[model samples]
Target: MTNTMWVRGVEWLAAAAADPRACKREWDHGEGVALLEAGRFWDVLSVPERLGLLTLDLLWRPGLPVPGPTLVDTAAGRVGFLLPPDPSGGWVGSGLRCASRGSWVAVPPPYRPARYLEWLVPPDGSGTLHGPGALEDALQQANGTLAVLAPLCGR
Candidate 1:
């Protein structure tokens, strides 16, 4: 990547950091990843990888809206979607998790892959995020589809 493109990517990813300068410093020092505190610029909602992938597909359908930055932790088999800070706590049950108020997420540095984390949907740096309602709907639909397909897939 050219310097301009790399800078742009970093500019967007910096929105997630508790200290954008610290994040940039780590990357500048050759770190591939940083631990970003949640609930500072955004929160996170994570689901099992299978369900999250399906949810992403639904969210990206032609008539639907694309979600904000998303990350998948290959080692942990989890997918996390960034949401606006202080998301609805009602969505906390049913194997779903919301990382806010003190939680942290392992994030890759801008367009690059980290140890076990990669961006599924990179942020645009425009402060856009997944709406709680839309995410919930898509997740429910994905969960239902997975439940139906599990037996047929023999999983």
Candidate 2:
């Protein structure tokens, strides 16, 4: 079944991309994660969608290395992506991969505005962050949270 929340998130991203101010304020990694954790952002996207957003965020950031590996913390785990390396030293945009999964997934070209919104947040709201090695712990915590919030989420 298609996830309605993911669809809504894509719509939100498209609208934000059309407005420069909205894009600037809404697309930051930290801020996006904050909103997701706070239930203010869509959080039902698939893992691939989440990775796609992370890759796009890196591309949008100024002065960040492109076509390289980057990692971020999420409620799921420490996800990573490798933006495809530029060819001829020119801007060659492509897809990325999540380190946790190690699978290359294609993203729409940067010119396109169908980017996914960030939905990965720290497992807990206590400001303590975990990494790839903490996957098991994260899963346990997530299960606990799900048990409590599933009803609230109408799941």
Candidate 3:
């Protein structure tokens, strides 16, 4: 999409976030389009501080594609979207799961702050240390990132 479209798309999302009772998630199934109403989720970012957090899988291997446009929640009664992952893609370490095409994995705010770094290393330092996985993994990563970023954002 062009820059204009990108800005417009974000604006649309922002608008949706303003309406507490209106929202939808749509997917193009090679047919026309499928739209699913998201209810209050669409209006989550109405607050002045509720920016979305797009959680990206930093650890990706060659040839694999990253799922994208991750949508997340914020602290100030708002929402935000995670920016898409880097196409060149960075590596966590050797023998780790990597991706050829990684997309933005949107998480939420109270859940973000720590995601920027913890994706590679776990806060507690346990487990297989995969980039993205079950709820447990996401919680660990998001919480860890938040612990670090919260202070910075406050100042």
Candidate 2's displacement at residue 127, Å, is: 22
* Model 3: per-residue Cα lDDT at residue 107: 22
Residue 93 of model 2 has an lDDT of 22
C-alpha local distance difference test of each model: 0.81, 0.31, 0.29
Q: For candidate 2, lDDT tens digit of each residue in 52-135?
A: 344335343467332222233343343433222222222112232222222222222122222342223211112222222233
Residue-wise C-alpha lDDT for candidate 1, range 1-155, written one tens digit per residue: 46665577688677667678888877667567888888877888889999999999899888666677788989988999988887455566577888897897778876678788888887766667898889889898999999899999999
Error of 1 at 60 (Å): 0.6
lDDT of 2: 0.31
lDDT of 3: 0.29
- Please provide TM-scores, in order, for all candidate models, with all chains considered together: 0.87, 0.24, 0.25
Which segments of model 2 are wrong by more than 4 Å? 1-102, 107-114, 117-130
Q: Which candidate number would show the highest lDDT if scored against the true structure?
A: 1
For model 1, the superposed segments whose C-alpha errors exceed 4 Å read: 1-9, 15-18
lDDT of 2 at 39: 15
